[model samples]
Target: MTTTVVIVGAGPTGLTLACGLARQGVAVRVLERAAAHATGSRGKTLNPRSLEILADLGLADGLAAVGRTHLPFRKYFDSAFVNETEPFAGARPSATTPYPASRWLQQPQLEQLLRERLADLGVTVELGAELVDVRQDAHGAEAVLADGRRIPAAYVVACDGGRSTVRKLLGIPFVGDGDPEPMMVCGDVEVEGLEPDAWHQWFGPQGAFMLCPFEGSTRWQLQASPETDAEGRTVPPSLESFQRLAARHTGREDLRLSDATWLSTWRINVRMAERYREGRVLLAGDCAHVHPTAGGLGMNTGIQDAWNLAWKLGYVVRGLAAPALLDTYQEERLPIAAWTLDVTSSGMAAVVKGIETPGIGVEAGGVGDFTGLSLGYGWSSLAGGGATDALKPGDRAPDAPCPGPDGAPGRLFEQFAGDHFTLLAFGPGARPALAGLPDHVRPVALDDPDGEARRAYGITGEALVLVRPDNHLALVAPATAPEQVRSYLEYLERLGA
Candidate 1:
């Protein structure tokens, strides 16, 4: 079958890109090797930035209904109670930042939400379709299934994960170091004698063990330092081993753990692909980069990667921008991946140090900046045209309460809710630039009677702000140069020509 984009993998990254592309009316085919959707509570935290991306996709209400916004860290040292602290304590939603705290929602739950949304967009995930090889040329790419079927597309994205088959097929090197000792044994199991209100952690001299209760459920995610046998090989994780660890670490045999659902061992492996693109075949999510599960960044970073690439891919697939626009995907996300590796590695080191030292508490070491709001593309060539003291090109477009065209209550995010660029005209002086906009650009004239929008955007005078489809600032031109807006769009069209 021929399609515009063939995505390999039905995980969060691939599903997110599929939803974004399908929302923009791009034909997409999602292939997953597994026969059915996998069941695991992997990567439970959805940072604020990821929540904002989902909010733009119109899933904010759905997420809020199911996700827990506040789950304090309840720490314990060797079966004794310590203290509780919430990382995002006192964080409230503001006009500029809507989703302020990280959410506790399991990966499977999120994938289900995305799948439902994708189904609404007339796309479905094709299961049991394992990609054996990929062939790409100047015009298009083809995904070869193990069962002797070929799927052709204009481009292919490898969201297949850390041990990506597509990356290996393309001969891309995954450069990083794997820890000599395995890190932790993790799984989802039914638990009793634990309240589902906080993340329960137990740290001892032998190793640390944690059982974090899932929101609105009786199951808790289990993570414990690996136990090795006589040969010094790490013992594989199982229900029996999990029960033993719970008894040994928490010093309570009454804490019953039963019905082990999913099990796996994790190691500290920090690595990223040397590049994100190989001709028409691009990489995203865990396929492009894999880091330590510190700060709960693994899934959030992948979600952001798909969001950053989706708009560019939509523009290129729809013939609105050049392939050079696709180049910026690597130019922008690669650095963020690198920074993630560095910080997560440090976070992991801190945890390991805490584990080795007595009486030292390790409190989610990589929590800083995990919100991902401060990350941007200011260094990219796509960022240009003026800046304010409060905002600049490549910064995230802040949301504000503004009146719609009918002079009714509205928000900047409502204007940005679909697959379109948003051109914000700060005042009547900047309204002229909103005229003659491209079909994909949505124009919003701000009537800030109380100066709320101006206060949020730091716009003392009239200005025109061109927001990318991903809600990042593309151009911050003066109101006098209305032509700059049109010229910028034309420049984008002519890029890579």
Candidate 2:
């Protein structure tokens, strides 16, 4: 079978990219090696920026309904109560930023949601289809499956995982540190004698143990430093070891752990691929980079990766933009991946050392910017044009309350929730420039009668702000210079040509 794009792996990253491409009217096929969807409470926190991406896909309200937003950190030292603190105590949504706090939900739940969304787009994931090899030429690519089936596509993306078959097949080296010692053994389990209100943590000389109760469920995620035997080999993670660790750390033997749903040992593996693209094959998510699970950056970063690449892929496959547009995907996201690895590694080290300090481990190396809102691609080749006092090219496009074309109360995000670029025209002078925009660009004139939108963007006079499909600023130009807007779009079309 042939498709526009063939995505290997049906995890969050591949599914997200599939949904984004399908929404833009691009044909997509998602292949997963596993016979069915895997179950685990892996990577439970969705940062605010990821929330924004999901919201753009129209899954915000559904996620909010199932996700827990305000779980406090209940810390204990040697089973003695240390303190309780809320990480996002005063976080509230504002006109400029909605979904300001992280939401805690299982990664599998999110995968199911994405699968449903993909299904809504008339696409279904083909499970048990393992990719054995890939071949590509100047025109297109072909994926050779283990079952002797060959699927052809314009591009093939490897979202399989850190031990990616495609990456290895392409001979891309994964470079970084891999700590031999196990950092922690974690899994989902059924627990009793624990309150389901907060994330409980216990720190002792031996190690640390945490039990975070899943919202509206009996399962709790268990994380504990592994125990060693006489040979100094780490004891494999199991329900018995978990129960023993729970009793020893919390000093509560009655706290029983049973029905382990998933268990695995996690080491400090901080690595990134040498490059993200080769010929017609590309890497994304864990297939591209893997890092320490501190600050909940793993799954969220992968989701953002898919979001960043989706639009560019759609434009290229639809013949609306040059293939060079795909190069910006690496130019923008590779740097972010590098930064994630560095910070998450430091965060893991701090958590291991600062076990006694209240909320230190929970904060994970003082990662106050883990919300991912401050990350931008200002140095990117695609980012150019002027900047306002409060915003610049490659900055996140802030949301503000505005009126729609029908003069009804609405918000900027409402205008941006689609597979199209958004051009915000501030004041009447900028409105004319909105005309004759590309078909994929959606223009919204913000009169800012009450100055709400203008104030949010820090626009004193008239200006034109072009927002990328991923909600990042593309360009900022003066209202009088409509040619700058056209020039910027032309530049993107001819990029890497």
Candidate 3:
């Protein structure tokens, strides 16, 4: 079999990449080792930025319908709510963005929704097939399946995960060690005498315990340090141990454990590969980096990697962009992977080191930082200067609710839902400029998206934001001259075309 891009791993990252490419009318094939979709909610929270991307792919509603939604609060050791933040509160975007706040969702639901979208694009995900071997040359790449079938592709992405077969075959080192103090985590369980609606944790004398609701009925993921050495090394979880721990911490012994779905003993670690690409093969998702789930950032970051790379790869495969443009994947995303490793590792260390302060939230940034919406690529190709008064490139694109030209309130994200550039003309008479944009760019007058978009852009009357395909702001200015607009297009032409 032959394809444009052969993606390994049907996890969120690989699927999202295939979907993004397919949406752009690029041919892609996905290979996964698992026979079916992965069960058990591994990455349980979807950040606001991810929600925006999902919405653009028309998958957000499905995710929102089945995934979890939290009001965003943090409980301290003393049980006092230091600060309950509603970051998504009153989120009225201008024409530049779509979603306002984050959604706490289950990864499985997110994956299922993405799979559906990929199917709609006529892309098929080949599950139960593994990339047992791969060989690359100057012309293209060939991936060998375990069942003796051979597949050819113009390029390949190794989203196979942390212990990736592709990364290993390429002799790339993961280059980091697991956390010195490992936290034993388990999710397969039936709990008794516990609140199922709210996420809870207890910081006690022995150790700490974090219990959060999973998607299914009567299930919650539990994480803690083993009470006894016997349980610590090769722990077989039991109801008694759960009840005893709950009693010791929450002063309640009514908790019961049953029907363990899945449990794993693993430690948090800050690790990244030396490079994301080796010749014609590239690494993404956990294959590129792995961090502790302390911040719920692992899967989200990997999905983001796919989102960032897919469009560029699509352009390259379709002959719209130079193959060298694929190099930007590592240039832009490796820094983010490194930063996530550091941020998540630090957050995990806080839990491990027992940094429980009364009325104090988790570390410097708290849960909001881990949500991944605040990811900044100030050094990216799309970014402008380091900072701006309002919107800037590399920042999460701002969104607003506006009546479309059709007079129904539409989201700013609705404009760039597919493979198109967004020219956000915020000035008075900017519509003419938008109407005149080239075929490669999609123009939407913020004035048309909604009344709030003007305010968000700080445009009392005039300004504009150029949003990239990934929905990150590209450029913000008061008024763009025709020459300036042409110049920006020329930049895209040079970089991508």
Candidate 4:
């Protein structure tokens, strides 16, 4: 069957892209290798910007209901609490964004929630259907499944993991090494003697060890970097090894290992694909870049990629833009990925050097502590290159409370809950300009129309803001100027929409 977009690997990034596309009424197919939805908890936290994305998709309430609101900061040295940043002061949401702070949650829960959203959007996922083969042409790409079913799509997006089958099939060199000097181990096990409410790390003689309590009691994630022996090989991991290390590090001799969920080794590799697109097949997520897990940036960066690409694909499929618009995806996101890799690589180096510095320097309640919302792309076509611009193309578009035209208090994002472009008009005078927009565009006026959005656009008084389907600010105008709007629409036309 032919579809608008065929997404391989129904992980968080692929699933998020599917949902975003489906919400835009674009036909999409998600092929997952797993027999069913994921059950294992992998990722640890969801950044505030991701939460805002979830909120726009209308899944925020469910996630917020189940996820734990992190409230405290606890750092340990030899299993003893040293100094902690005031948890309440760590991160805060912007007055413009609905979600100001980050939340802690399991990856399984997030994937399950995203899958439910896919169902809500009427997009079905083909489980246990792995993409064994792929062939791309000038027009489209055809992906062959393990079961011998061939699916054709206008475009193929590779959201598979680091070892992506599509990526390998395309003969794209991964172009990176494992850690030059590996020094980290990660395993899920049921262990005693740890607090579940906080992330606990213990710096010891040979290397540091960390115990992060899982959702259930007696279950925890034990990660440690053991000293290499004379031959330069660390000891193989086992329950006895973990128990002995725990006792030795924490002075908690009574600790015992009960169940081993997963035992795995980890390394830091900061690498980017030489190119994000190969003909009609494109790559996102870990398939595009792999970085150290210093700030939990891997999955989050991929999700943002999904978000950035989804709407552009939809626009192209709907005959609203030219295909060249797809090129912007790589141009805009690759730099962000490169920057993230560098920052995380530095952070990992600090950790390996046994330097006890903060991952996020701000207090627990401050906005500066999180990595999600603060990332910006200055060189992209999506952002307005205005001085002191509040809403740039590569920056997040903050939401605020506004009254609908019906004179009731409503949220600016609530209007975006559906599949369509939103034309946000600030001040009373911009309403006529919004009304004159094409039928494909949805219009919204601020109840207490202030120039904050105008200020974001480097304008004053009445201004018009064009928001793409994926919530990106396409263009901003000082007033009801149709020329600027038409210019952007023409640009979108050149992109294939």
TM-score of model number 1: 0.98
lDDT of 1: 0.88
Q: Candidate 3 vs. truth: CA RMSD?
A: 3.6
Every model's TM-score: 0.98, 0.98, 0.88, 0.90
Stretches > 4 Å off in candidate 2:
356-359
lDDT of 3 by residue, 260-371 (tens): 6656666666679999998789999999999877667777788889989988888778766667778888988999988887777777666556535443333333433665
Q: List candidate 4 stretches off by more than 4 Å.
A: 86-94, 215-218, 227-232, 355-370, 384-393, 449-459
Q: Which candidate model has the greater TM-score, 3 or 4?
A: 4
Winning model by lDDT: 2
TM-score-better candidate, 1 vs 3: 1
* Model 1: per-residue Cα lDDT over 1-497, one tens digit each: 24999999999899999999999899999999999998899889999999999988878878977869888888788788877888788999998898899899888889999999999999999999999999989999999999999988999999999999999999999988788778899999998887878888788787888888877777889999987779988889999888888888888978888999789998888889999999999999999898888788899999999999999999998989888999999999999999999998888788877764544444547645889999989998889788876888899888899886688898888888887889889889888888888799998889989888888778899999888899999988888887878888887888878
State the TM-score for model 4.
Answer: 0.90
Ranking by lDDT: 2, 1, 4, 3
Model 1, position 243, has a per-residue lDDT of 88
lDDT of 2 by residue, 1-497 (tens): 34989999999999999999999888899999999899989889999999999999878877977869898988888888888888888999998889888999888889989999999998999999999999999999999999999999999999999999999999999999898888899999999888889999887677789999888788899999997889988899999889889988889978888999789898889999999999888899999999988899989999999999999999898887889988888999999999999888888888888786644546766554799999889998889789998989999888899897778999999999987889899989989988888888998999678898888888999999999889899899999998987888788778776
After superposition, which runs of candidate 1 have C-alpha atoms over 4 Å from their true positions?
356-362
Model 3 residue runs over 4 Å out of place are: 71-101, 230-251, 355-368, 384-388, 448-451, 460-464, 477-480
